[model samples]
Target: MTLALKYAARSDRGLHRSNNEDSVYAGPHLLAIADGMGGHAAGEVASKVVIAALAPLDEDVPGDDLLGKLHEAVVSGNDTIAELVDQDPDLEGMGTTLTAILFGGGRLGLVNIGDSRTYLLRDGQFNQITRDDSFVQSLLDEGRITPEEALTHPQRSLVLRALVGHEVIEPTLQVRETRAGDRYLLCSDGLSDVVGFEKLAETMQIADRQACADKMIELALQGGGPDNVTVIVADVVEEEPQPQATQAFESSNNHMHPVGPTTSPPRPPVQMPPQQPPPHQATMQQPPQQPQKKKKRGRKIAIIVAVSVIFLALIGAGIRYLAYTNYYVGVSDGGEIAIFQGVRGTVLGVGLHRKVEGSCAPAAGPDCRPLRIEDLGATNTTRANEGFPVNDLEAARRTINTWRSEDQQPEPQQPVNCPTPLPGSSATSTPTDVPSLPGETPPGSSTQPSC
Candidate 1:
């Protein structure tokens, strides 16, 4: 019961865009699509970085470790994107949607994040295999919007989760059994956004895999391919007698490796040659060098080390002084309310951090505006960053509450009681205005407090 994957992939820049921002990788066992998102071509860079991360996993892998390897690759991709953003100050806010599938024997492993999609057509039934992490999807799940409404929703493409160079990558991972007739498709919003599910099913029903992909891109263009389109169409087929097989796809700009008909053979991993250490390790491992040279080198090293240590110490002390004296609250690179040693956002691509223990959310009030007007579950990170720095969650809450309270106008206060006279009798009283409370002052009262 051996299984092999036959996949065809295609990417197009579409009518509106001059350059194709979408990237696709198709191999014997792995198929992936990444939709870039950002201005100034940063999105293209992000998508290609992700594809490159997944390029090494094209061969068959262990069924048990497939999910783990996929996770590691995607995590590495996110970290690489973070490092890229760190290197380039202008590439901030770049992100990409990744949807990938790993075929390990008869089981299909899917790792997805953001709004790209993976779909399955089996036994004449059609199903969307991956859930889109989008604002409108949340609305649809809450029964707030209908399927038709989701298509035209203003914020439909506003992805809720994505690999945006964050410290964490939360792609959904799943393993599912496959049958001979099962057909799978991985695509970006460029195709799924335009072609309806029924249209997709009808297009997939086409006999030729390349034609299926080409038709999908065609329909997407007909529906106004406002974004870059990328598609991967793969089918599960029974093992044949042919020991090796390779196919070229006319619709694909990328070439997929020859998926063979023979059972996957276990290949030994490439090993590096054993070698002696170059400098530091060799010095530490070897016994004391010649005593005379050692003493002379050690003395020179000691002086140099001492001077370097002194300089570093002075710089560290200055940094500590500034940290404690001029600390403030701001959102970290990971979008958490954090205390920083310097300014809120990074300056010149260099970041500052002092771990704070809390997450801030919008204060639910009748008068409070919704943080994400179109995105239902999105928290107002800006409002969260407005809070002052505090030690714990409780204090963070208090700080944010205090900030909000200060923002509101003070309520009118009641008039203070003086020694007033009754109907028939008069009581003596000081002819001066009185204060009610620290934060309160009565209307029409002229009371000025010490500055």
Candidate 2:
């Protein structure tokens, strides 16, 4: 079955901004939102250019060809904006973030750049489909921070990649299967930054699309929309026969299907026939369209599987970091006490840690100790402080020495065991020395597990 959308979209200047720097387009199969950046009227121009560039993909595109077509549209937008910036020095920094979706042949073509977002609401679970190309997002990916931390990060607004007049724009693209009851949302950061995802999921459950879009806008306003806000709320419904004229109609306007690449503005609407032809007559001129289901499977199940794999990968990484980076004073193969950087034994077929430079000299080998624990692979700054386990390597040597000194002390003064001197000759046998720890030397022996 062919996939399509029933969507509503709106753009607001917002409470703080004097003018709306956001541009939006919503249609049966094409939905997009752009948030422009820069001062002066450049923001508006950039956003408008982005929407103009992407407006053509609304027409029906086959699943196999959809990805290429989407790329062409985005490249056109990037080039147009870059050319404008080059032509005018004042608009040099002006650029816009574009997030759009093309739905056809039961799959969605996703194109994203900058911080604008795309989200999917399936099976009562809301999942963000696109990742942001921002600085804080990199931190999150590196495991330095959690998703909750990224939201309120002071530098969250600092985007690393955007459509700004770059010679080359690296836009993110993906294709996913679309379902009959699925709902998709595209919005500018003005709405997303202020509105929490929980609230969005709750409000999106409203039956009416317009009502849902309005509620989202209202929530952004209540949160003091600091920038221009744009929203598109679209729900996928069962495909049905659409009248020929209605195919050209959009939620915002009766925009015609853009034919070819041109710098010109939106084309004038085509005049319709006075008498509408029967639905049967329309089919004769055009072949029936078929939806191409590429890898159409259980979407939520796929999500769960992907999430499980990612979670396991993260846990495995954390465990390895903890095990491999451990450093402490321990016994070496030569029976000499020394500081060890890695874990004592092999785990998962890898050493716990390696020897690093430090104050304690390596007696077994001629190598030196690491200057700090960080030299051993604990790059995260949070764990470098005094709270670190065995952080004081020099002090650790002192503790190990105390243990050795106690072991060397003479046994407590107590009553001696009197043995019966039988007539046999076994009274002269000496007592054997007792060992203290695993791999430890005899009590009188010098070397042991120590730093």
Candidate 3:
């Protein structure tokens, strides 16, 4: 089956920011988010330039060439930034984080730099698929801090790498197979930094992509929106075949515009016939002719009514097909996890889906657990209320199994003390020499806790 993306994109200046410094694009073949950094409005310029440079790559590319095209485009963007800096000394420090995905040959080619992120929701699992190129990420990788401590860490925004105009930056790139029901999210650190992963996962579970995007922005704003936020949500789905006639019409008329008075040539004045004397009422009546006219009018009305009915029927059938082909995992009326068929919510107050069966089947596997809403915790319970949409019944089952496995895992340990710095390491240097971690006093300062 042919695969295509159904996607939505959004950006917000945010409650606290004076100006938006983020750029985003979502198209049939590409999705990208860029978060800019600098001063004097240079950040905005950096992001816009990079986005414009990459926008042309939204067209179809051969699957094998996807990564090559993405890499070339990114390097070109970086070069453009360097040129701009040369033209204007004031823009010297401008740069931006880029996270983008190109779709081709039923696969995804992803490119990332800086702290912007890409997350995936496939089958019944959700997780971040890109590692951040930032100092905080480095700290986490080295086991010097826990995920929780990293959030409030003062240098959380200290990016170790990005598309600065000074040099040709190498970005992380990879390709992965795509599935029809997978959902992907690309966003700036503005959203990822403020919104917890649990909230993000729950919001991504929304079946309506547009709604999911909207909720993500709202969550960022609620969390004090310290930076400009941009989000792109895309879903992979089987492409529906279009009638050849419709396709032809669309191709021909897509750019056509209606004639307006300003552009149209002056109409020739209508020639009028000389005024005629009124005919007698009897002659004007034309009784036999009137019957023929009425018959023709009746036939036209009947034809229009028949066509209208047929068109409506076809539309209803298409909607029903879309509603039934998907499935979701949600809490049932009895509060137990259950598998459902069809889309969530309703049309004209009629439910669009029904419970197919309880998610937990004792005989299915040892991992199967009868989970209820009360047991799911706040974030997961919220997800259940919204429903975790999946491609099919099997996907729904996998999601349930994933939840069961997570439930069986142990609790996380508390944050530990920061490790001692190695000789000549940056960690022991003064702030001027190198950035210092949280809870670590710079040289000449009073002693403090090491965590």
Using TM-score as the measure, which candidate wins? Answer: 1
Worst 10 residues of 2 by lDDT: 247-256
Give Cα-based local distance difference scores for all models: 0.65, 0.63, 0.71
Model 3 ranges with Cα > 4 A deviation: 241-451
Steric clash count of candidate 1: 0
Candidate 3 lDDT score relative to the true structure: 0.71
User: Over the full model, what C-alpha lDDT does candidate 1 score relative to the true structure?
Assistant: 0.65
| Candidates' RMSD to native | 18.2, 21.7, 30.8
lDDT of 3 by residue, 238-331 (tens): 8552110000000010111111111112222121112221210001122343334432332343334324423443454456667888898998
The most accurate candidate by lDDT is 3
48: Cα error in model 3, Å: 1.2
TM-score of each: 0.55, 0.55, 0.54
Segments of candidate 1 deviating more than 4 angstroms? 60-62, 241-451
Model 2 agreement with the true structure over 30-123: per-residue lDDT tens digits: 7888888885556666776666666545534445777788889788878877876665555668788989988874788898999999999999
Per-residue error for 339 in candidate 3, Å, reads 69
